[model samples]
Target: MSTAAEVSQNNNVGPVMRQGELAQAVVEAAEIDNPDKIIKVEDKVAYLRIQTSDEMILKRQTIEEMLGRPFSMSEIEIELASFAGRIDTQVEYIRFYHAKHL
Candidate 1:
């Protein structure tokens, strides 16, 4: 076994964070929604990645159709802007994750 300094002395220095957990979270969420796309979350952040395997883009496009009327571009912008402002005003909780090497 070698210390991080010793490892870094010879090879690339930093530890790599694994994406399995994030991918699993996204897959789980997609399965629950029965989405046609393969969805994935990025780590613990409020981020998502969706791969359009099937005609999954249609599912997203249908949201407006289901609502009967389409919202104007300005209306959508205003709603999203308000949501962002509300999120910015809220308190955020953080937790530390410790990784154990074997």
Candidate 2:
């Protein structure tokens, strides 16, 4: 059994990414969300852990806008090492959040 505080503490969500250009783009895109969020990026030699509290969203459009080129959301998978929480992927955006919160 878990208390509210436990749930809150475990609510952090994001992706562990393979290091390189793709991971860099994803991390940059995460920082550019409209409502904005505090994102934490940890370098782990071969990979990077990118996380935010409660929820985080990355838009294909935003990624493209940042890169100044055509970008496919699926391309992210190439760099994704792992992810926390449930993922809702759309043509326009990808979201990570706890199912219980939804």
Evaluated with lDDT, which candidate comes out highest?
2
Error of 2 at 10 (Å): 1.8
Model 2 over residues 14-91: C-alpha lDDT tens digits?
Answer: 889998887888888899873567899999989999898778999998888877789989888888879988798888
Which candidate has the top score in TM-score?
2
Q: Candidate 1, residues 1-102: lDDT per residue as tens digits?
A: 988867533211111123344233323433444444343333333323332222211122232343345522222222221110011111121111223221
- List TM-scores for all candidates, in order: 0.21, 0.82
lDDT of 2 at 50: 89
Clashing pairs in 1: none
Poorest stretch of ten by lDDT in candidate 1: 81-90
RMSD of 2: 4.0
